[model samples]
Target: MDDAIIRRHLSVGRLTILEVLHDEPGIDEDQLLAEWIRRRPPASQAHARRLPRTIAQLLWQLRNLEWVDDTEGELTITALGEYVREFARLHSPSPFASRTSTVGGHSA
Candidate 1:
């Protein structure tokens, strides 16, 4: 686990955003959101209502952390983000690592 990634306190949503950007570096926000929603849909109708705002906030936070960059309405992961993704992939107990994974006594 990387200290930089660990310090980010990344949630599943944020992690998903990073992974998607890592896979598709120049996708726009709509595409990214669509993929994220497809992969991790909201819990309920109410959650779906709040999903856009929440995802926006998460993306905003990642931007502030310099993990992602959005230029001309397209998003791309930074090197730091790739580092985080690699750490998550390696440390994750299962596929598409969860933020709450308890493997190796690491939970974040």
Candidate 2:
């Protein structure tokens, strides 16, 4: 995967979550998880299990960054997050090709 794409996804995940919640207030964790899962492409069982934990961590980080407001069990995106998302989408990676690195007999 492209590093830029990965970074964008990591950043956008939080924004998307917030956007969804904003459109539908009072959404719970389960609903958030479900929507995230639905948005992702089909994956293996192992990947499916791991995705939730990854998303949880991302949400935690966003909360720590003060880009999201978590009250009770609900979440809302801060102004900073919305602005960042807009900027990121404007500067998203190209769809042509990306750089790769080879290390320790592995290609990344």
Candidate 3:
């Protein structure tokens, strides 16, 4: 759940899912899909909107990692999940951020 653990496994989509679960505990798969797509960038929303069936796979990975719990059609973050989410927000730079900008006289 620390920055190093997160940075090693980080992906924008995974991070978003964790954050969503943090804010919307007990959400269902259907609802999580809708919310997830809603939170996605406009361009990806169109593609994600067509892949409702893939939600299970996404949730499966998170569950397998012990980052989330799905019980009785409801989802919630585990303590480690919340820690990952908060660490991402407070310690990680946006994965999608424009790294083309210069830093320390070198392009990031």
Would you estimate the TM-scores of all the predictions? 0.79, 0.65, 0.73
Q: Model 3, 42-74: lDDT tens per residue?
A: 456566566565567767878877888989988
Winning candidate number (TM-score): 1
Model 3 spans with C-alpha error above 4 angstroms: 1-3, 41-46, 96-108
List the candidates ranked by lDDT, beginning with the highest: 1, 3, 2
Residue 68, candidate 2: Cα error in Å is 1.4
Per-model lDDT = 0.74, 0.59, 0.68
Residues 1-108, candidate 2, lDDT per residue (tens digit)? Answer: 343543434444555565566566566678878877766543678877887787688788777766667789887777765655554455555321222211111221
- RMSD of candidate 1 to the truth, in angstroms, is 3.1
Per residue, candidate 1 scores C-alpha lDDT tens digits across 1-108 of 357546446556667888889878899887887888788776688987887787789888888878899888889999887877777678665634543444334433
Global lDDT of model 3: 0.68
Q: How many clashing residue pairs, candidate 1?
A: 0
Lowest lDDT block of 10, candidate 3: 99-108
* Model 2 misplaced stretches (Cα beyond 4 Å): 1-25, 93-108
